[model samples]
Structures are given as structure tokens and as C-alpha cells.
Target: MLSLLPQRILRLLEFIGFSGNRRFGLSQLREGASNHSLRSILCAFTLLFYNTYVSLILGTGEGNLAEAEALLEPYQEKYPKGSIILFYSARITSLRGNLEKARARYEECISSQQEWKQIHHLCYWELMWNHSFQQEWQQAYRYADLLCRESRWSKAIYVYQKAAILSMMSAEELERTGEDLGALFRQVEGLKQRLAGKSIPMEKFAVRKSRRYKASNPVPLVIPALEMMYVWNGFSIVGKRADLTESLLVTIEKVEQQLQNDPNPTEYHPDDSCLVQMLKGLCLKYLGRFLQAELCFSEVLSSEGRIRYDHYLVPFTLYELGLLQKQQGDFIKATTYIERAKTNYKDYSMESRLHFRIHAALNSLKGSPVSTP
Candidate 1:
């Protein structure tokens, strides 16, 4: 159990940046102290140190860097064998743009946690992070392959996606490398098959409604209409705009009316509202009502506090807003929105069709080059 202490500590560390580390450390100390006898003071102290270390790893508010460092300093002194502390310490260094130190710490983590399957995911993430920073696709691909072999499916998918992204990063690289663009398509197809035997339905409104309790507010019709807009975006990306135009426009109009009619429409849900606004903006943009499209994007930007992490619409809105600004010849404002989109893209878990549009718009801006594969 003491050996598993490091992993537990690391998990806590990941959350500390978002939630304070001291509070988390104190809580763990209380729990462990309460359960163990007086002679177990050493164990209690170890747990406390572990928890504190985790808090440092997770906490990421403004001006907390010194506090994070102070929290870790004691652990380095108290538990010299706790190499996981070093791994997390390196993450902070990486966040500060100290790439060499971060690379070394991750390498140490890989060496120490070689036999731990669960920890392999973290190792892969670290490797991917390092390779991504250095733009070393071959190394990244190898690490990704190792992750897939180790049964870290989600991380593997991300690695493969990153590979595709790097290939798309530069046309010269793509042409010289002779990379297969179909790799991503093949991986997605394989994932679909692996998931096929399982009954994981796409997360449409009906599926969500059926899974929830009867009194749990049923999915509003507009929610599905918004999802249809995402479908429209996908088709539009694949040059199937004609297939989605009529239905997508009609659905958007219906959703807009529904939003106006319902005194408390579920569209107020941040995720749903963002999607609705984004789709509305897309429709208006395509219809050549640039001003109305800008309004929709502005509405989304203004509602940042209500933004949901799961919704891709926020970044989509930012990207669209960038395009709209670019069209209006507001280069500086366009760049700002595009940069916001790029930052948000780090958190986006899935590759969507709308990204191509964002990339195209960005390429037209000065200092923003589109990578084609």
C-alpha cells in the first residue's frame, strides 16, 4: 500500500491546482490520523506529504506559484524516496516553460513506474507532451504505440490524433515525410468496430432522455435540433453542405422560436445555449447576415461564466468570431479570437470537422500558417 502511495499522491496533485493543496492535505491528514494508532505517526506524515504534493500539482490559480513551490519543498526534504513528487514538480516547471527539466522528470517517472499499467497513461501523456513541444512526430508515434499496447485507449487515440495534427502542421513536412493521411481514418474505423459490439449509442437527446429518470426534465426538442447542426457542420466539412443546408436552416429557425417561447427553456443550460448560439451564428454566417452572426458569437463570448467544459461550442464560437472579424478586415481583433480558439483547442478532446474551417481562416491571417496534409 505504501508503494501505491505515490500514485494516489499524484492523482491528488492533479486536482490541487484547481482546488487548494493545503486544504486537501489537511483533509487527508485528518482521515489517516483518525484511522491509525499513535505509533503510525510516520505513516500519517507520509500520507500528509503525499496529499500536499498532490495539491501543489493540481492548484493553478493566479499568483499561486510560490505557494505551490513552498508546499513541495518540505516533501523533497522529508521523503527523498518519493520520486513521484519530482514528476509533479517537473509538471510545474513545464508550465513555467522549463521544457528540459520537465522532460527529465517525465523520463524519471517512466523509469520508476515501468511495471504499473495505470501509471503508463501518465507516462504516455508526458512523452506526448515532450514530443509535441519538440515537434518530434516519430517519437510521439512510438510513445503512442506503446500506450495503445499498454491498453491506454483514450491516450492512444489522442496520440494518433496528434500525429495527424503534426502532419497537418506543415505542408513541407507532410510532403517530405510521405505520411499516410488515412491513418486517422483507419484508427477511427478500428475504434468504431471495437466499440460496435458494445451498445454505446451516440449521445443524442433521445438516448440521454431514455437513460435519465422519468421526472428528470426530458430533453427539449431544440437540443436535438442543435445536435443536428453539429451534424450539418460535419457534412459541410466533407463538402456535403448541400445535404445539410435545408434541414439545418429549418431546424435552426425552429430552435430559435422554441427558445423565445419557452419561459425556461433548457437552452439556458450553458452547453445547450452555447450550441444553439453557435449553430444560429453558423446559419446566419452562411446566409450572409454577417452582423447577426457576429451578435451570436458575441453573446457566447459574454456568457463565458456559464460555459460548460464538455461543449465544443465555446471554441467554435471563438473561431467563428475570428473568421467574422477577419472578413470585416479587423486583423488585430481576428487574431485575438483565433488565439483564444487555439488555446481552447488544447482542451478539446475530439477532432471535429469545424476545425478545418478555423484553420483555413487562421491561415489567411498574418503569422498564422495553415498546415496541409
Candidate 2:
């Protein structure tokens, strides 16, 4: 508690892109959690949140699930009905790819409280992703729709998510939704919210993607739901489940084939296809098709000059390629590419998020000069 009292200061440091200060914040929380005082429990909770939730979103989705579980195990038994504990517990399970257990825990988390609907919203959000990982489109849509109707955290994201989920369904399945996908995407711009006098990075990304819907004759987004999932680093988590990754790969391949045969091309064609290719690389990397994965990532880099709308794609592909190179025993190449990604980009969609991943990659490469893998 005392250690985390200055957490807002630490967060401000991270928000401004200070990597060292974020490390210091985590260090202090670790020391605090080592103690046996009353606030030690609070410190543990803070650390657990950082490891289980914040790190996954802001870093590489490479959270320390083991440490998170060790911190929460005792308190979880002590306060089984504690909303925040249940939340972190569920998150740990989800990160470990235990969706069924996570779903039950998230349900318990929701039913544990009625006063703080915000807590319920968090669970709903996780539940949405849980179903999404399993390709349960309608179920995911149910949670996303609930968020769109009730949550005020980020209405643009919620509404966009609702529409994205609908996009994943069969026409007969989608006919039941009765919601206009284009109109919902268009609604994103109007529903966007600002934070701390600045536009939220993710909301801005969503609004930008939704811009096509505003065109006189809109071109449907190719697997926009998967695109958003990639932004959140969801692929890293889902990659652990072969079934999930294969399902996502199938969806992406469908778009890839469509793009190849697209007779009516737009200015954004290369950019769109490159985006799909990057996602395919991610899926392929997890599926152990490393050479094919490298090809997909290189295709994005090869077409970088042609990309118009999504400038972020190049740097992100570089980062992904760097990680793959790191895995293939090429430390110098990995370090060089990851550093280029870190230094050569700014203000793109989820740029900061990708920076954190690049930072993690660079750090590991520095620690393993001979290549860890």
C-alpha cells in the first residue's frame, strides 16, 4: 500500500514512455510484497495486477503467470469472494490458456458483486475475449453487446467490438444480430472518448479503422475483429492453444485469398493485405511453421513502400520478425531489427504498445548475446 501510494507517479512515468521508471516501479512493488506487514497484501495485489493485467496490455503479453499465482494463491483462499482477487485469478487462468476455468472464475467474479458494476464490466470484457479465443462468435457478441449497452470506460471500443464480433458470424448467425455493421463502425468515431486531455491511443486506432465505413461506398474491413485482437496482443495468448491459432489462421487465409482475387482494388489494398499477412505470420509462428512465418513477415516489409494508411505495420512486422530471428539463433540480426523498430517509429496505432514489446525483446537479446533459443 505504502509502496504503491506513488503508483500514479510511476504510471505517469510509464505514460510518458520512461522504461527505466516502470522497471523501478515494479522493483519497489516486489520489495513491498516481500514484507509480512498488512500492506504486504496490498503490495502483492498491486504486483499481481501489474504482472497479470497491466504487463499483458502494455508489454509483450508475456506476463509472469507463475509469480502472479504465487502472490494470489494465499489471498485467494483467504478471500474467495473478493472481487479484485477473483479478477486477477481469472486473468491468470486466461493467460495460461485455461479458458473454461477462467470463464467459471470470471462468472464468479461477476456474481460476487452488484455495487461496483465496473468490476462486472471487467469480467464481461474478459469473458468476451474468452469466447473469442474459442471462436464462439455469438457468445462473444453477447458480452460485447452488454459492454456497449452498459460500460462507459471506452464506448468506441465496446461498440466496435460488438460489430467486430458480429462480423465473425455466418450470415444466418449474423442475421440474428440485426445490427448494421457499417453503422456500428461509423458510430465508433462519435463514441470515442478522451483521457487526461488526450485522445486514447486505442480509440484513435479504432476510429481510424472505422473511417472506411464513412466512405460513400464502404469497403468492408477484412477480419477487423482479428485485427483488433492482434492490437491487444491477444494472439500471443491464444497462440498457446493450437486449436485457437489454427482457427484464426483459417480466417486470415480466407481474407488473403479474397485479397488475391479482388478485382476492384483501392489505394489501401497493399496495406490491407500486408496487415493480414502479418497476422498470418503471427499465427504461423505459433503453429511452428517458422519459415512460412518469416516469409509472411518479410512480405510486409517488402511492401512497406506501398503501404499508405497503416504505417504502423512496418515497424510491427520488424518487431515480429526480430522475435522470430531471436528464436532462430540470430542475436545480432534480432537486436538490430528490434532496435530499428524501436528507434524508427512514432505515433502510429499502438506504437507505444509495440515499443514495450520491442524493449522486452531488446532486453532479452542483450542478456543473451549468443542467442537464448
Taking the tens digit of each residue's C-alpha lDDT, what string does model 2 give over 195-303? 7899888899889988999999987777878888888889988998998899899989998998999999888899899999999999999999999999999999999
User: Residue 64: error of model 2 in Å?
Assistant: 1.3
Clash pairs, model 1 backbone: 13-54, 13-58, 16-58, 16-59, 17-58, 17-59, 17-60
Candidate 1 structure quality by residue, lDDT tens digits, 1-373: 2122223344685667533344465556546555646734554445434433322222111123454465556566876545566665765565454666777777776676556666656766666645544445567655655665666445324433444434423457655556554343234333432355652223222233222222345342234323432433322221123333444556556666766676775534665566677777776665667898899888888877786444566676787688677666677788788778765664342323344344445545746433211
- Model 1 residue runs over 4 Å out of place are 1-63, 78-81, 134-139, 153-156, 169-179, 192-311, 315-373
Q: RMSD to native for every prediction?
A: 17.7, 3.7
State residue 282's C-alpha deviation in candidate 2, in Å.
0.3
Residue pairs that clash (backbone atoms under 3 angstroms), model 2: none
Clashes of each: 7, 0
Candidate maximizing TM-score? 2
